[model samples]
Target chain A: MTNIITICRKELKSYFSSPIAYLLMAMFAFLFGFFFWNAVGYFVSMSFQAQMSGRTIPMDVNEMIIRPLLMNVSVIGLFLIPLIAMRLFAEEKRSGTIELLLTSPIHDMEIIVGKWLAATILYACLLGISALNILFLFAYGQPDWKPLLIGYLGLILQAGGLLAIGAFISTTTKNQIIAGAVTFGACLMLWVLEWVAGYETATWATVLSYMSVVRHFEPFSKGVIDTRDLVYFASVIFLGLFLTARSLESLRWRS
Target chain B: MIKVEGLTKRYDRTVAVNNISFEVEKGQIVGFLGPNGAGKTTTMRILTCFLPPSEGTASVAGFDVLQSPMDVKRHIGYLPENPPVYPEMEVEEYLTFVGRLKGIPKADLALRVREASEKCAVAEVSKKLISKLSKGYRQRVGLAQAIIHNPDVLILDEPTAGLDPKQIHETRDLIRSLAGAHTIILSTHILPEVEQTCDHVVIISKGRMVAKDSVQNLTSRLRGQEAVAVEVTGGDNAAIQQRLEQVAGVSRVVARDTRDGRHSYEVESLPGCNVRGDVARAVVESGWNLHELRAVALSLEDVFLELTGAGQAAEGEKQ
Candidate 1:
């Protein structure tokens, strides 16, 4: 456990020190902030101007404020997580530093988890930086903190699933470019599975949608912590990590 | 202590290492000799537990490599042909990381890193990033990392593969300093390095172990004839040569003219025949002054060529 934490600390330090990590953070924040304003502007145009009002439209600041913030974080995270996780194993393998790690007393599982935890913490910190927007929303109106908390939880769950997939892709090759591309491709395919469900037949669509990470994220983003959704994300993370461990174990024999 | 029995590794259809068996007792510096692609690296990798052998078994310090890989890893320090190093890391940081990975106690990690840095002569570059260091310094750092754990066996594949003459001498001296305490198996293509450093030489060719024995015995066996070169005066060259050839146990003789018109005869006797007395008597009876006569022994280079079938005629002529 100490070894894991030590490796994790060093990895996190590396992420902070490299310009790539900082550049990704800046881009994510800018895009997320821009989308949040657009979402709020749309809600305002819908509520005012005496458009069509038969039902009581709850276009409160909470919907205009919290939902957009959560939605922005999730969407921006789709691009940001893979960039940080791309070098987890790919760089090490390319430089032959994997031999050092593999020959260590620590198990392969520890190395995968250490690098994943590093990326996860960096993602959380970037998300935390956007909390200033949430604080401003709190000053204007009574927004339920539950949705914000659930929104953050949803982002964590989604990012955990993406990170697992990213970790596995990093193990498939020593080229960071290929690792990044494959990870983005995997994440994008999974994200589009919900949309694909609309065209496919009912049973096939349901099964695909169940596997879709964004579908499982919906319950968490709506201020409801469904145990089923949490389990789904956890399972995805575990399965990816397990595959990564197996791949690492078998690389010597295959090579 | 190291023991290998029928160990082999094949990559697809190519046999990188055939069934080769050898042993190293505690405190012996053995040289792994072979040309490129001769399975020296493959055999070392198997001994270090970096790769699984396709067949047979090897044990280091009584730990079976196949059955107890972790134990084998803990007991061996392996330096591959190319030093596997992280260029971005500072020397001390990299050594500390390796020390920790090798399961050195935390309390002693700093001390071990310091000792290793000093021993490998990388103490001055301990704080410098490895990328900034020269190749020789980087190789030294590699050696430091390999020895940081103080494993029972050290398997170095071409430790002096690329270096200047001075650096090679320095590296050889360092390896010699670690002789008694570390059971080292170093591989090299340089023949003289084996004669100079190793007590025993294991020559591999085409993925098979061709010869394994002490350097002295190998040379003696290859020295098939008891050769004696004699420079004599006051003799007809043909008569002296013929008389020497007719001597008992003398298989052949060749005569040559020295610069001062003195005749030199090279006498080749049958194996195990000490005909130095007969050759001297024959030369004297032919009314020639026996200026010099001694048994000429074979050099290690001769043995290497004969055993590996390289430049054999050239070695014979040099005699």
Candidate 2:
């Protein structure tokens, strides 16, 4: 356990030491801020229209502004998670530092989990940026914090699954660009996998939609946590990290 | 402290190390000498638990590498060919990180890092980023990382590869200082390095063992007889050669070119015999003018070329 934390701390420090952490954070906050403004502008205009029509009903701020804004944060994650996990293994292999970790008195599982935890924490930091944007909404309106916190929980699980996949892809190659591009391609595919359900109602189509990472988060976006979705994300995370361990095992044999 | 039996490694169809076996005794520095691509790095990697051998078995400090690699790793420190350092990390930071990874106790981590830096002569640059330092400093940082945990065994693959002459000397001295407390196996194609620092020599050629012995024994073992060079000035050249040949324990005398009436003779002595004393007495009793006399031994370079160059030919015909 100490080994894992040691590697984890080094991994996080390395991220901050380079410009990747700052660059990604800047890009994420910029894009999320744009999406936040759009979401709030649409909510204000809709309420004005209802008021002009003399309706007595007050609009729900949680549904109209925060929910979609947080959902858009997941869309930003599709672009950022790849960047977060690309260097986890690829940089080590490219720079030959993998030898240090491999020859040390640490297990392969510990190294894998340590790097995965670091990337997950970086992703959570990105979510925290979107959270700060949500805090602004709290200053002017009374939106229930419970639903926002639940949505953030779903975002964390969803990022965990995707980031794990990205980490696994990193072990297959030493080129960080190739790792990042392949991971981005993978994250984009998982996001669109459920789109097939719109055209076909077959059993395979339902399975495809069920496999879509975005579809499982639909309930969390509405402040409802389903056990089935939790299981799906957890299973994805397990499968991704398991495959990463297998890849690193083969790497030792071949290299 | 380390043993291997028929250890072999194959990447696809190419054999990197083939059926090579050798042993390293405790507190001794064994030089792993080979030509380029001669499986020296592969053998070291297997010993350090970086790669598993495709065949046979290797054990370090009584732990089989495959059966109990964690134990082997805990007891070994490795400096690979490339030095394996993160470019963005400060020298002190990198050493501390490696120390922690090697599981040095939290209390001793700082002192160990400082000790390693001082030993490797990188203390002056400890606060500098590794990428900002020169090649020599980077190599030393890699070395410091290896010894930070102070493992029982140290496996170094060309530890002085990128260093200047003075740094190489310092690194050799540092390695020598670590001898009694640490068993070290260092690989290099540099022959004099072995002559200067190593206690034993393990030579491999074309992925096969060529020779393994102490430096002194290996040189004499290759040449069945040791030669002593003598320059004599008083007697007839042929007569002096004959007189030297008649000395006790003398095998043969080959006379070199006479310069300024001084006859130079190479006196060969039979194996395990020191004819220096008897040769001097024979020359002195004869009242010959002895200008210079010294025992001449073959350098390790000649032995390496003779073994590896010949081994390649023998292996070529076998294939």
Number of backbone collisions per candidate, in order?
0, 0
- Among these predicted structures, which one has the highest DockQ? 2
**What is the lDDT for A86 in model 2?**
92
Give per-residue CA lDDT, model 1, range A1-255, as digits (tens): 777776787678677756876887788778777876786677667766435665566666656667656765776777887797799889888876786676555677888888888878888888877787667667766788877788898898789889988988898899998999889888888887888677787898888888987788777767788898989999999998888888887777765
What would the C-alpha RMSD of candidate 1 be, to one decimal place?
5.7
Per-residue C-alpha lDDT of model 2 across residues A121-226, encoded as one tens digit per residue: 8888777877777878898899998988899999999999998899999999999999999999999999999999999999999999999999998789999989
Best by TM-score: 2
Report how far residue A146 has shifted in candidate 2, in Å: 1.0
Minimal lDDT window, size 10, model 2 chain B: B310-319
For B1-319, candidate 2 gives per-residue lDDT tens digits of 9999999999999999999888888999999999889999999999988899999999999999999999999999999999999998999999999999998999999999999999888999999989998888888888889899999999999988878999899889988998989999999999999999999999998899989999988776557567899988878988888899899889889877798899998888888788988888888899987788898966887788788896466546755
Regions of model 1 farther than 4 Å from truth: A40-57, A139-142, B223-302, B310-319
Q: Give the worst 10-residue stretch by lDDT in candidate 1 chain B.
A: B310-319
Q: How much of the true A–B contact set does each candidate keep?
A: 0.35, 0.89
lDDT of each: 0.83, 0.91
